[model samples]
Target: MITEDSEFLKGVKEDDNSSFKAIYEKYSRDLFVYAYNIIKEKTVCEDIIQEVFISLWAKRKTTTITSLKPYLFQAVKFQIFNHFRNNKFSREDLTRLNIIDVSMNVSQKLEYSELDQIIRDHVAKLPKRCRHIFVLSRYHHKSNKEIADELEISVQAVKNQISKALAFLRNNLQLEEVAFISLILLQ
Candidate 1:
């Protein structure tokens, strides 16, 4: 029998069903474990693993993975990071900086992701460099030096970019405007 990794490589290269099944059966548990380590939320970890596999299968023909295990685990890690990074709480923390009260209601729960997406859409419109600096500082909580190193710029440049971006956002958004946007985006 072809080794499981070999099967996956073949499927990824050839779109073969048997190889795909072998790949799924062999790696699902490992993928789940990897995702759990990064995500810590059981439900979210499971979701990440599922999405990883679905994406793997969908993109199999175009993928050129030399090592199935590491590639899958890294994919899981990236997915987990993206989910938490995109979660509503991060956006709320950014614009509101206030503690939120959660109630036990389906509608309330369902509104969060919608709001996050809305805010993300607006943030995406920001200039590319400004957006990168802002997210690194706000979401990733990186220091100026860290952001500078990551972006391969001077620390002063990092600080200047953040200041300019914040000033622009503040000018464009008044208190009421920010509050309204926050409520609508984070509803």
Candidate 2:
């Protein structure tokens, strides 16, 4: 027997409007909840969900989504990350966004919050120059060249300072925490 997901995919591939509407009705609320946990803004979350569905419809003829739920969730995650990155959110905002998992239990959320605080505290402990370079690169989304030019330093100096800052942070945080922080910084 063909699975429900396959049935949906077939309908979507055939450009059926009702199928598209069905997909949206099924996934939009969960996607919105997932996004809101990170973005904490109703309007922006709604817009992101709308964009995802719009893109889905636009790509339906060409795209093949084997698993709709994961695909939708991943799209929402990327959109939320882009929103955070484009808006130049602060480290605190990044921290809040990074550690949130809507599927997590209460204890997990508390653990994530503690880890977030640890990362923030360690970042605060970096030397002034290192912290400046790190913040310029990560929080402000500045290129190494831009940061160097603004600081009146060589690009290599900026790179070195960022490296040093990351090294310092790595020394204090666990491997998983470091990875999580790196994901936020790099993205």
Candidate 3:
């Protein structure tokens, strides 16, 4: 069955100009806002979205876009990330990029990745319920109530399991300088 949702993708893949225009009109504003929020520059955000659209149009015949919205947003995200990475950041600029650490030195990013891997290993060792709750909270970014509902547990139980998991990680891991840089970035 050809889903109504994918009509646009199919039209685009078949080199239909109206489909490309409709897709742009639908997603461009939201994409621009997302890029602007991350980059805090109007011109750069505009250019990024333009580049994303142009790239999408170019790749339409060759690439499969099952979900148009994510493909658009992900392209903008990569462009924004590239902008941050290619350009030098002042300490002030670094502070504004939010929790994303584009300013991290190569070695610091490496340390951060190593620390993250170690933490994931320890998370895997947790009891099943605790690990599930913690993964929902951290990796999946779910609220306590949401996790509770999904797991059929009390909100307090969700909180307790997340807390227990965090406490376990704290005891097991030695987060030092590299992690401190991450903390500073978050602040």
Candidate 4:
């Protein structure tokens, strides 16, 4: 199916200015609102959003985006984080704007969301039984005993299924140990 996001991306790749404008009109307000919430500065938020759009346009020819919404949101978040990291703001200044903790939270959220998408995509490619067992264990927070009982399988079978799933994901994702551990902890 040719989704709206795919159409927009196609237009962008073809250098359609109107398509870019449509994207800006559709997402700018939400992005601004999100940025303003974190930065608490209208001018700074506006600048960040503008820069995000400019960067998106500049990279349109090279970037392959399956989903534009999350990509844009993540870009805004990275820009915000960069603003905090690059500027020599004092603790008091950061605290005064209530930005320090919020920025950290946004950073974690971006990581988690990206990892979650990767995990979901890999899970979808798993074998049917392995996918079911993995989803039950990770998404439903079910124990091996519970999943085995529900599926009329042995706990050893459940363990094997989960192991297979993890092996596939680990091989495909090639995630760092810390990142993979954090993902498991989050689930």
Candidate 5:
């Protein structure tokens, strides 16, 4: 937790309205924009933000928040994901939301959408352990050390597994395409 947000979390846990409002004011706009990017619906995005803040306040006392910013963002993400999932979204639509890379332009996002589908198809063929590690490192953005800790494995093993996964992807994808995907995904 950052020192600043830790203070907010402490105050919120003690039912301080000002602390809760401070956190809301700081994050709500950013959260709305983030949700809007994926959802592209202003009303839905606003509702998701409201729901996230409400959930945060409702659970402040019981939830073990290690990082307040990430927890709040993730809550908004969860709501959006569920909204898509429960509304009969196609696999491609979900994939578009699943890879929310704001760095890409409209055309690149379309291109990546097609490319992402291809990569996912190939990634599905990976061994279970390799697939899990790759998803953790690329999709979830977990550090190799963090993944190793969570998986109860050595850092060396994590590195070797990631190497194997990348090698497998390189072999299966366009000879040079995985390089581009890796650059973005590894970020």
Candidate 6:
């Protein structure tokens, strides 16, 4: 018998709504819980799961996904980290709250949420090309060559854009910014 995830994935590949529903029914809770562990916001967790599924559907044609579970998990991890980074959560707050462990006090959790909003606010202000390059590299995990080819630019140009964006963020944001930006670019 075909497994549910594989079947739903097959249906999703064919752009079937029922199959998409099945996918949501099967993974939504688990994915949301995982996201909540990272983001610690019930509302944001729902949004993240929705965004992840929407992204999966949008990229279905070109995504070459073999395993849905791992891909979904990867998406959640990135989204959560992005939530944290975009918020520019202060190091002192991060340390005080022990965000690495989700078993924190409620007040600390609220603080984390506020910080995430701030980070998102600043990231939204980035220049057009810089923002696109950052999003493509960070969110879509595109390589320099792939980004260059897609944008009709030289690989060196792609590299320069990434370097410039990273430098800008590093200068303006905290050290945590370096980790995710590097993780996205170097991956």
Q: Give one digit per residue, the lDDT tens place, for model 1 in 1-187.
A: 6666876678666868887777888778766765564446789878888898889888877877776766775576467546644675554444543222233267755665554455566667779998888777655445688899998999999988778766666566545445423222211
Each candidate: what lDDT? 0.64, 0.76, 0.72, 0.74, 0.75, 0.68
For model 6, where is the 10-residue window of minimal lDDT?
178-187
Q: Cα-based RMSD of the predictions, in order? A: 11.0, 16.2, 6.5, 12.3, 11.2, 11.8
Local lDDT at 75 for model 2:
79
- Model 2 per-residue lDDT at 14: 91
Residue 99, model 2: lDDT of: 32
Give candidate 2's error at residue 126 in angstroms: 32
Question: After superposing candidate 6, which stretches have Cα over 4 Å from the reference?
Answer: 92-187
Candidate 4 Cα errors over 4 Å, as ranges: 90-187
Ordered list by lDDT, greatest first: 2, 5, 4, 3, 6, 1
Candidate 2 clashes: the total is 0
Q: Higher lDDT: candidate 1 or 3?
A: 3
Tens-digit lDDT track for model 6 on 17-131? 9988887887789789766755678999999899998999998778877767768867776666567756878766453232332334798567556655545555567788877
Better of 1 and 4 by lDDT: 4
Off by over 4 Å in 5: 99-187
- lDDT (tens digit, per residue) of candidate 2 on 9-50: 789889888888888887788778767866779999999999
> Model 1: which ten-residue window has the lowest total lDDT?
178-187
Q: Is candidate 2 or candidate 6 better by lDDT?
A: 2
Candidate 3 lDDT over 1-187, as tens digits, reads 8765489888888899998898888888988877786677999999999999899888888888776665676677668767876798765554444334445789978866776677678889999989988877766545689899998989999989888886787677664522332221111
Top lDDT model: 2
Summing lDDT over every window of 10 consecutive residues in candidate 3, give the lowest-scoring window: 178-187
TM-score of each: 0.44, 0.55, 0.55, 0.51, 0.55, 0.49
Residues 121-181 of candidate 4 have per-residue lDDT tens digits of 7789999989998988765546689899999999999999888887787678753422432
